[model samples]
Target chain A: MAKKKTSLYREFVKGLWDDNPVLRMLLGLCPALAVTNSAINGLAMGMATTFVLLSSSIIISLLRKVIPHQVRIAGYIVIIATFVTVADKFLAAFLPEISKSLGPYVPLIVVNCLILGRQEAFSSKNNVGRSILDALGMGTGFIFVLVVLGGIREILGSATLFNLQILGDWFNPWMIMILPPGAFLTLGILIGLGNWLNERKVKV
Target chain B: MSLLLLFLSAAIVNNFVLTYFLGICPFVGVSKRVSSAVSMGMAVMFVMTITAAVTWLIYHLLLVPFKIEILEYVSFILVIASLVQLVEMFIKKMSKPLYDTLGIYLPLITTNCAILGLALFSVLREYSFIESLVFGIGAGAGFTLALVLMAGIREELELSNVPKPFKGAGITMIVAGSLALAFMGFAGLI
Candidate 1:
C-alpha cells in the first residue's frame, strides 16, 4: 500500500515539473503558443484541455486491455477526439465569446500531442486512479504556463490583466507583445529561464 | 486572380508555422539540418495536400449530408492516421531513395497539427473542393519555405555563440519570433 501510494505521488509530481508537458516536454506547443494572447483565453483553453485530458486518460486506462496493440494509437485518438468534441461543444454552447476567440483551436485539441502522449505513455500502462492524477498534474502544469505567458503578454501588450488595467497610462503598451512574434518570444524566453533555473537548482 | 491570392495568402501572408503555430513539433525537432528539413517539409506537403482532398470529400459527402458534423474531429484524425500508414507503405515499395529521404518523418506527420489544421481551415473558410486543394498546396509550400529558411539559419547558427540556456529550442523560438515579424511584412500584399 505504501509503495502504491508513493508511485501514484510520483506519477503526479513528475508531470508538475520534471516532465511538464509544455515547459519541458514541449508536447503541445501549438495550443501553448496559439491561444495565450490573454489571461482569460489561456485559462479557458487550459481548462478545456484539462477536461479532455482527464476524461480521456480515465477511459483509455480502463480500456487498455481491451484495445488491441496494433490499433491502440487509433483507439486512443478516437477517445481523445470524443472528449475534445464534448469540450468544444460545451465551450461553444456556454462560452461563446471565448469560444469564438479560441476559434478552430478548440477543435484542434483533437490533435494536441499532450493528451495522446499521456494515453500512449502513462494511462495505457497505469490504473485509472494513477492516470487521473497524472493527467491532472500535467494539465495543471500546462495551465500554469499558459496563464503566465498570457499574463505577461497581456500586461505588456495591452497594459491589462484579466481585462483590468494593470499598468499606468504613462506606460505605453508593447504592441508586439500581443502578436505572433510575442507568443514565440515569450515562450522562448520562458523555456530558457526554466532550463537556467533547473541548472542552478541542480548545482546547489 | 482569386486563386492566385488564395495561394499567396496561404503561402506567405499567413504562414501555418508562423501565424497559426501549427506543426511546431517537427518545426523544432527536424529543423536542425536543412536537408532533413526539406525532406520533412516535402513529406508534410505531400500528406497535407492529400489530407485536404480526402477530408473535404468526407466532410461534404458523408458528414455534411448525414448531419453528423460533430464527428468531424474523430473521422478527420482517423483518416490522417490511416493515410500516413498507407503512404508509408506505398513509398517504401515504390521508390527506395524517396522513402529514405521522407520515410522517417511519415509517421510523425500523423500528429502534425498542420495536417489537421489544413483540413479544419479549409472547412472553416468554406472553400470549394478545388479551392481547398489550392489552399493545401499553398500552405504546404509556405511550410516548406519557412522550414527551409529556419534550417538554413540554424545551420549558420551552429557557429554563433548563443547563451547557455538559450542554445536549443529557446534560441529557435526567438529566431522564429523574428521570422514571424518579418513575415508580417507580407500582410496586405495580396
Candidate 2:
C-alpha cells in the first residue's frame, strides 16, 4: 500500500517536471506557441485544455476495459472531441473575450496530441485515480510553461505583465517579441534552458 | 484575382507552420531529412486539400441544412480520421511506390492540427467552396515550404554545432525563428 501510494505520487510529480508535456516531452507544441502571445491568453488556453484533458482522462480510464483494442483510437478521439466541444462552448458563452482571442484554437484542442497521448499512454492503462492525477500534473506543467512563456513575451513585447504596466516609460518594447518569430525564439531558448537544467541535475 | 491573392496570403504572407503555428509536430518531427520532408509535405498537401474540400461540403450541405452546427468538431474530426484511413488504403491499392513513401505520414496527418486548422479557418473566414479549396492548396504549399526549408537548414546544421543543450529541437526552433523573420518580409506583398 505504501509503495502504491508512492508510485501514485510519482506519477503526478513526473508530469510536473520529468515529463513536462511542452518542455520535456514536447507533446503539445502548437498551442504552446499559438495562443501564448499574452499571459492571460496562455492562462485561459491552459485552463480550457486542462478541462478537456481531465474530463477525457476520467472517461477514457473508466472505459478502458470496454473500449475494444482496434477502434480504441477512434473511441478516444470522440471522447476528446466531446469534452473539447464543451470547453469551447463554455468559453464562447461565458468568456467571449478570451474565446474570441483563442479563436479556432479552442476547437483545435480536439486534435492536441497531448490529450490523446495521455489517454493512450497513461489513462488507458491506469485506474481513474492515477489517470486524474496524471492529467492534473501534466495540465499544471503545461500551464506553467505557457504562463512563463507568455509572461516573458508580454513583458518584453508590451512592457506589461497581465496587461499591467510593469516597465517604466524608458523601457522600449521589443516589437518582435509579440510576433510569430518571437514565439519560436522564446520557446527554443526555453527548451535549451530545460535541457541545460536537466544535464546539470544529472551531473550532480 | 482575389483567389490568387488568397492563395498567396495563405502560402507566403501567413504560413501555416511559421505564422499560425499549426502542424508544428510533424514540422519538427519529420524534418530531419530533405527527401522525407518533401514526401511528407506532398502527402500533407494532398490530404489538406481534400480535407478542405470535403469538410466544406459537409459543413455547408449537411450540417447547415440540418442545423447541427454544434456537432462540428466531432463530425469534422471523424471525417478527417476516416478520410486519412481511406486515402491510405487507396494509395496502397493504387500506387505501391507512392504508398511506400507516404505510408507512415498519412496516419500522422489525421491528428495534424494543420488539416483541422485549415478547415476551421475556412469556416471562420466564411470562405466559399472554391475559396476554401484554394486556401487549402495554398496552406498545404506553405506548410511544405516551411518544412522543406527547415529540413534543409537542419541538414546543414548537422555538420556544425556549438552548444550541447541546443542541439536538436532547440536549434531547429531558433532556425525557424530566423526563417519566420525572413518570411515576414512577404507581409507587405499581400
Candidate 3:
C-alpha cells in the first residue's frame, strides 16, 4: 500500500521538470511558444489550460473502463473539447480582453495534444486521484515555462515585466523579442537549453 | 478579389506557422527532413481543407441557424477528431502506400492546432463556404512552405558549423526569426 502511494507521488512530481511536457517531452510546444508575449497572457493561458486539463483528466480517468479501445482517442477529444468550450465561454463573457488577445488559441486548446496525450497515456490507465495529480503537475510545468518565456519576451521587448516598465529611458526595446519569430526563437533556445540540461544529467 | 486577398494574406503575408506561431509542434518535430516535411505538409493541407469545408457548413448552417453557437468549439473539435480517424482508416484500406508514407502523421493532424485554428478562424472571420475552403488550403500551403524551407535549411545546417549558444534550436530560431522578417516583405503583396 505504501509503495503504491509513493509511486503515485513519483508520477505526479515527474511532470514538474523531468518529464515536463513542454520543455522536456516537447509534446505541447504550440501554445508554449505562442500566446505568451506578456506575463498576464501566459498566466491566463496557463490557468485556462490547467482548468481544461484537470476536468478532462478527471473525466477520462473516470470513463477509462467504459471507453471502447477503438474510439478512445475520439472519446478523449470530445471530453476535452467540451471542457475547452466551457473555458472559452467563461473567459469571453467574463474576461473579454484576454479572450480577444488569446483569440482562436483558446479554442485551439481543444486539440492540444498535451491534454489528449495525458488522457491516452496516463489518465486512461490511472485512477482519478492520480490522473488529477499528473494533470496538475503537467499543467504547472507548462505554466512555469510560459511565465519564463513571457517574462523574457516582455522584459526585453517592452522593457517591462508584468506590464510594469523596468528599464530606464536610455534602454532600447528589442522590438522583435515579442513578435512571432521571437516566440519561435525563445522556445527553440529554451528547448536547446533543456536538452543541454538533460544531457548533463544523463552524463552524471 | 477579396477572396484572393484572404488567400495571399493567410499563405504568405501572415503565415500560421511563421507569423502566428500556431503549428510549431509539427514545424519543429517534422521539419528534420525535406521529404517527411513535404508529406506531412500534404497531409495537413488535405485534412485542413476538409475540416474547413465541414466546420464552416456546420457552424454557419447548423449551429448558427439553431442559435447554438456555444457548441462551436465542442462540435468543431468533435467533427475534426472523428474525421481524422475516418480519413486514417480510409487511407489504410484504399491507399496502403500513401498511408505508409503518412505513417503516424495522419492521426496526429487531429491535434495540430493549425487545423482547429483554421476552422475557428473561418468562423471568427465570418467566412462563407468557399472563402473558408480557400483559407484552409492557403493556411496549409503556408505551413508546408515554412516547414519545407526550414527542413531544407536544416538539412544544409547539418553540414554547417553554427555558434555555440545558437547551435541547435537557438540558431534554428534565429534563422526562423530572420525568415519571418524576410517573409514580412510580402506585406505589400495583395
lDDT of each: 0.92, 0.92, 0.85
The alpha-carbon RMSD values of the candidates against the true structure, listed in the order shown, are: 1.4, 1.4, 2.0
lDDT of 1 by residue, A37-155 (tens): 99889999999999999999999999999999999989999998899899999989999999999999998888898888889889999889999999999999999999999999999
- What is each candidate's fraction of native interface contacts (fnat)? 0.79, 0.78, 0.71
Give interface RMSD (Å), model 3. 2.2
Docking quality (DockQ) for each candidate: 0.86, 0.86, 0.64
Better of 2 and 3 by DockQ: 2
Model 3: how far is A104 from its true place, Å? 1.3
Q: Which 10 consecutive positions of candidate 2 chain A have the poorest summed lDDT?
A: A69-78
Q: What is the lDDT of candidate 2?
A: 0.92
Error of 3 at B25 (Å): 1.6
Docking class of 2: high
Q: What ranges in model 1 sit over 4 Å off?
A: B94-105
TM-score of chain A of each: 0.98, 0.99, 0.96
User: Can you write out model 1's per-residue Cα lDDT over B51-169, one digit (the tens) per residue?
Assistant: 99999999999999999999999999999999998888887898788677665456768888999999999999999999999999999999999999999999999999999998898
Q: Compose the digit string of candidate 2's lDDT tens values, residues A45-149.
A: 999999999999999999999999988888999999999999999999999999999998999999998998899899999999999999999999999999999
lDDT of 3: 0.85
Q: For model 3, what is the alpha-carbon lDDT of residue B125?
A: 85
Model 1: residue B6 alpha-carbon error in angstroms = 0.3
Candidate scoring better on lDDT of 1 and 3: 1
Better of 2 and 3 by TM-score: 2
> Candidate 1's error at B53, in angstroms?
1.1
